[model samples]
Target chain A: MEWDWDFAWSIMPTLLAGFRITLIATFLGAIVAAVLGLVFAILRRSSNRWLSRGTSFVVEFIRGTPLLVQLYFIFYVLPDLGLRLPALMAGVIGMGLHYATYAAEVYRGGIESVPRGQWEAARATNLTTRQTWLHVILPQAVPPMIPAMANYLLAMFKETPLLSAITVLELMNQAKSVANSSYRYVEPMTLVGVMFLIVSLLSVIALRWLERRYGRVSQ
Target chain B: MGDWAGYLTLILQGAWVTVKLTLMGSALALVVAFLAGLGRISHHAPIRWLSTAYIEFFRGTSIFVQLFWIYFVLPMTGAELTPMQAGVMALGLNVGAYGAEVVRGAILAVPRGQHEACIAVNLTRWQRLRHVILPQALPLMLPTFCNNAIELLKATSVVSLISLSDMTFQAQVVRSQTGSTLMPFVTILVLYFAMSSAISFGMRRIERRVTRGLDGVR
Candidate 1:
């Protein structure tokens, strides 16, 4: 019940190690989300009707479902289907796959914000479709999306605790283990909460900076 | 088929719990959202500071951590809470922090001309907010509020970790008992998707109804 500084100090190393894994999972998962989300965004806008509709359905389904359930499916059912993944790998993929739906929305918004005039101008100048996208559309689209994407990064980081459910040794998992072993719930749980608070607050400050720098453009 | 049917019934019972948590949590979140959101823009500095602190602290920590702390550590400090109570509180407060921002933004987005009109008529601040500002702001808040409601629904899944026996927890129970991982997980995923879709659908209807008279203002 009482605050035990010694107990908290003793568990610091274990919690820190777990925090390292949390950071790694978040970083790798962000990469997966960024790339996959872009792919999803483009595919949803494809010329083929079936491809666009199918992509939209998949994105909607993923967005509608909970990340925790998605994590459970990837970690539990995949092994039964003869595809085993380590907890961290499964966690990363689940986080990436889940957040990708959101990131795709950001990308879609950014892409849509590029004016019709720009697309017409590209065509009038005799730019090829690919060149129009590469040289003009994306250059205009990507900047505003950065802050939204970074917000999701922080969101995924907060959710790294959920990775503990799938057995990843993230900060929450380590704290739980320490709590279980020592039969002391207060210190470790509070520490985990404090750690998350610190990281999220810092990321929020960074996101504000990003917004100020890139939030407004002439689109 | 019989065994599967039995599993479905059990999972439905859990689904009921999930629905209850989502509804109760969302109701509490709505109250907290309005309070903190309005408080943030209050005339007094301390009121604004207090709301800001409330929003930042809850928003900064993940809901899972908050649930565990409430369920586990809060009792140590003498405030015992049932799992359901804790789930509702954590989900409400956490999601409320987000809803607060939405409320603030919507209020701010109301045209500056509208505020000038309120002052020109010599309405008190409370009368202005209640009669003029809130009516306009309420419609603007609906779409984002719909999204936040879906978010709160998904968040109820995390309450399962605290042994709350929400749909996610019941799925685990079914999985362990039947030794069938896919069925339980798949069923709940569909259920969750359905619930979220329902929230969006209902919100859309309300949004349409609310904006019916004020066509060009939006």
Candidate 2:
């Protein structure tokens, strides 16, 4: 099939709109991942055995399951339980929860890597628990987390196409719509793939820059 | 489909399929990935380039699109396979690419001192790799391989579109028959969640055992 610049040019506007949705979903999902990551991290380290094990169980369960199944659960199950999230909300929640399992691991690694002496010093100075966490441990642990976190962010961006299953008009959905209406999978699907590749590549490159920008954590 | 007991049995059936797909696909991927991974680190340039190209091509595309290409497009070109066959093939190839990276990385992680020792002892190439290198690499590779295994297991759900009667398909069946989307989906999600959590827990235990043995060596 011949490449048509005109069709590609015309589709850009639709894909751009889809790009906006993708960005929003990725950004929002990252927020949940960050907060929930901290929660999981703390829970996994808690002195209480049940809490830590339970949290670990949750993390493993979520990690092991496919995000697609999770999405289906959120979309199909919620409405029957007398609640209905917007399709986008469902998409974002599934992405957030699914990736939170991974982010928890990253957070756990970051937290565990904090020097034991730091905790000892915190107790020596008689800092409050909150102060110990906020002032000392997090500062040390979170810096190295930036690059890994950014990588997850990009991963989430690529996963937005999976959101189309729930009827979210993300880039792939738009491409599918165009393809279905016009019967041209050749151009639309290829374009969608190319667009995703370019954006994700840029995201990865930017993340590499962030790693260099915050090398203290790793170095 | 809506009867709780009947729904239970159907999901159990689906769970069986999910297990089969996950195990079979992972086993195939492990074999292919090991070879490609070895090729990637081979002495020859062509082997290296071919492995690299394979990895990059598969990794660059989304697995969903790839599944569609193999399942939907291949039939039109006169190469016909069942949805289950195509699904397994796609999953195997896709996961193989990522596994190759893990395999290569794990091999490289083997200590350089060991490599030098092997050379000093005049061990054959295969002897050094098989006896010394792979043993060390295997344990280090366990944690990452477990991670990929879980990821690939979860991905087996993508095969539902080609009409494989996996857990996802069973959930769809219940959803269609009962119109009670929530119950069926929630049940299936929990089913998947349970299976994955069990596997991961087992993996962690294995990793601990492997690491303990490594510590003993030191």
Number of the top candidate by TM-score? 1
Instruction: Report the lDDT tens digits of candidate 2 across residue range A74-175.
Output: 888878787889999999889988888778888887888899999999999999999999999999988888888887777777677788888999877887
Question: What's the true lDDT of residue A216 in model 2?
Answer: 33
lDDT for B50 in candidate 2 is 98
lDDT of 2 at A100: 84
Per-candidate TM equals 0.98, 0.88
Model 2: which docking level applies? acceptable
Cα misplacement distance, residue A124 of candidate 2 (Å)? 2.3
User: How well docked is model 1, in DockQ terms?
Assistant: 0.88
Per-residue lDDT of model 1, residues A64-183, tens digit only: 888999999999999999999999999999999999888889999999999999999999999998999999999999899888888889988999999999999999999999999999
Q: Which regions of candidate 2 are displaced past 4 Å?
A: A1-10, A46-50, A213-219, B73-78, B201-216
How do the residues B42-78 of candidate 1 rate in per-residue lDDT, one tens digit apiece?
9899999999999999989999999999999999999
Compared with the true structure, the alpha-carbon lDDT of candidate 2 equals: 0.82
User: Worst lDDT window (10 residues) for model 1 chain B?
Assistant: B209-218
Query: What share of the reference contacts survives in each candidate?
Result: 0.88, 0.47
TM-score for the B chain of model 2: 0.94
